[model samples]
Target: MAFAVTSSTAIRSSLSTPLEQPKAAQVGAFQPSDRHHLPPAAVNFSRRRCAVKPLNAEPKRNDSIVPSAATFFASEVVEKIDVEDYGKLAKDLGNASPLEIMDKALEKFGNDIAIAFSGAEDVALIEYASLTGRPFRVFSLDTGRLNPETYRFFDEVEKHYKIRIEYMFPDASEVQDLVRNKGLFSFYEDGHQECCRVRKVRPLRRALKGLRAWITGQRKDQSPGTRSEVPVVQVDPVFEGLDGGIGSLVKWNPVANVKGTDVWSFLRAMNVPVNWLHAKGYISIGCEPCTRAVLPGQHEREGRWWWEDAKAKECGLHKGNIKEQNSNGGVHANATVQEADLFNTNCVVNLSRPGIENLLKLKSRNEPWLVVLYAPWCRFCQGMEQSYVEVAEKLTGSGVKIAKFRADGEEKPFAQQELQLGSFPTILFFPKNSSRPVKLSI
Candidate 1:
């Protein structure tokens, strides 16, 4: 969902009114005026002295703190918590408040737990953790494409909480390889999954490697389609624990059942630091290129990956359980190249340089067709190959011709001039008797 703190009601009410201009402040500096619409707790917290110590004032490490295998390098260093025990704990806290859940989680995992602080809900988690007066960890994914405002907010959060956040980054070599092959904005041409895998998922995997349990601000209402069944606590199936031992990796979604309004209430009550972009209407902030401010009445998810269909909304970080729906009416994580090739051979018309020009000429003849312009290197394009072929097969005898073109190869120039290709794997529909083609949302 878009990452913002204001209630939908408040946002809608303010839409017709002019926004108060913000006062000039240092870049990344917090402005008092930003809290104008927030609840009374926010104002109070901002005015009073918060009970947080400066980072230089080192607190003694708790002896109960257990280290992950990577960090400790000794199997006997810490007692292993059973996964079944965690299941029972989740059951016990099933109806507990978010703060209660956080307190329990911190007690169980101690310093081994790291809060995945990214959006507004995360800051609330931080606040709750701080209220527990326990040593915990916080980390964020620095995708390198984050907004300047986000960097400023990072500083604000650190200063406010008096905590150091470990900023994880993607591997330099992998990023260099992706950019070298696809350029900086390949995600615009293709879908965001590949880019997200590189920028977010991998880095997150690295960050979790040394932790026993990790916390997230995920809630059921965030994305009903993708996150509705999110459990408060679970043994993360997608990621393994530090040493592949039992009870190594646990994931906690303390606010899993909490509503967006409740999260905002908590944040306001605690006067927690938040991203300034939230004030501008970004509810679920991610990378700058992918995130945008949402209109008052729109769902928060609409602000993210606006180009893709709802089913494709996730960026693979939380998609470990979602089954990929293939074009052949089947589900799987991946399709074999042989299956994709076979499907393409049977139903898809492969277009070359001359083939593309000829297809364009057909526009004058009032012939209509659906064409897929793709790059062989694009992972999204490759994943959709079988699905496109399935679509083609369905329309085989329906009088409409289905075709495919290699945008990065033979039809590159035509795709640029005529197709106006913006990202990898663009699909367009040429309606009969029309000179222009319409891009189709996938």
Candidate 2:
């Protein structure tokens, strides 16, 4: 909702340079733009290009209860809200309340986490913390190009709270040079994402570093695209690298359970810091240049980048992250392997002691055994290790046994014979009577 500016030098060292440009068709082939100042070694050749998606889809089902102006502020959680549901939404704020949701969220998340305060829902969060006698860290991204109103709110919040808000600014010199050459509004004419790359997205990646978990103002009533079932606490892959490669372990959205009218009621009741622009009917806020007023029937996100093609409403944050992470060629972060009996035929068992009776054991036991070949070093393989271990444990009580074979390093002869049969993390299911195994690639 808002960006905070801080001293520049510290900002530069704290941030990882963003990827150069979007990737083309070739897998694992991408050029790093001069957007951020990432080192060459950290370039991550395996990182794939991420595609951006619009934010105006029906809010994720998980966010169905988010209060919005269109809903007339009802707090009811509808079971089947669709794009058409917007037309039938109530405009009153009787049931949908922000304060009630904040109370519930605080009780659940505790003081161990912070929220993504961008000055929009930020006012409510700040006031709620003060009123409830709960102290929490206030964090926000400082994209060098923030609106003046947001800064005023920042100062006001600090004065009211008697605490310094953590300011996450962009690299000073990098922003200066990029803005100088490209011009301040280049992103408006060319692509807003480019501007976001240099400001919001990259800076956010840096600011999120070292946080154990965080809270966001995201709600379901905002868009159809986010309407999926929302989870109170979930792993956010976007910030996975925040703390030494593996990022924040948890993300909480307490407002995910709250809707719109509730926010205004609390603001009035608590006399929270209200933004001047909101008085002019701006329900949501972002960069002033890119954001506009939403008409009565328009989607909540219709105001964002209104000049762009309707289908291209979103900036680079959400879309790019999902695209790059889903692709097989992309960096492996979240991976899971599920194994099941591929064939009806009973499989043979193969038993052997590492040092002795290899041939004799194989000859004596007619049934073949299932073996999972994996490399511990491979990131993808690492994700599957737990699943394989679970299978090994499950099969222990049953007559079927599971065997683990390292694809590389040790047991060269055995590795070459069974483990080396395919790429790392490959599963081989051998039938009860057959010597040959079926390769399972997931």
- Candidate that scores best on TM-score: 1
Question: Model-by-model lDDT, in order?
Answer: 0.61, 0.46
Candidate 1 local lDDT, 1-442, one digit each (tens): 0011122321121112222232321112111111112122200111211122223333333211222110101111122343355567678889999878887776665545678877444778877776665555677888998888887777666656555566778878868977997899888877776688778876776676555578888887887655766778876645534443223467898999998878888777666667778889989888889989999988888889998777777775654333344559655532222122222343577777788776676645434677888764454564454356546655657656678787875567768888878886688777666677778666
Regions more than 4 Å wrong, model 1 = 1-83, 245-247, 321-442
The residue-level lDDT of candidate 1 at 272 comes to 61
Score candidate 1 by TM-score against the native: 0.58
Q: What is the lDDT of residue 178 in candidate 2?
A: 65
Clashing pairs in 1: 2-283, 2-284, 3-283, 3-284, 4-283, 189-423, 189-424, 190-424
Q: List runs of model 2 lying over 4 Å from the truth.
A: 1-112, 227-229, 241-243, 316-442
Query: How displaced is residue 191 in candidate 2, in Å?
Result: 2.0
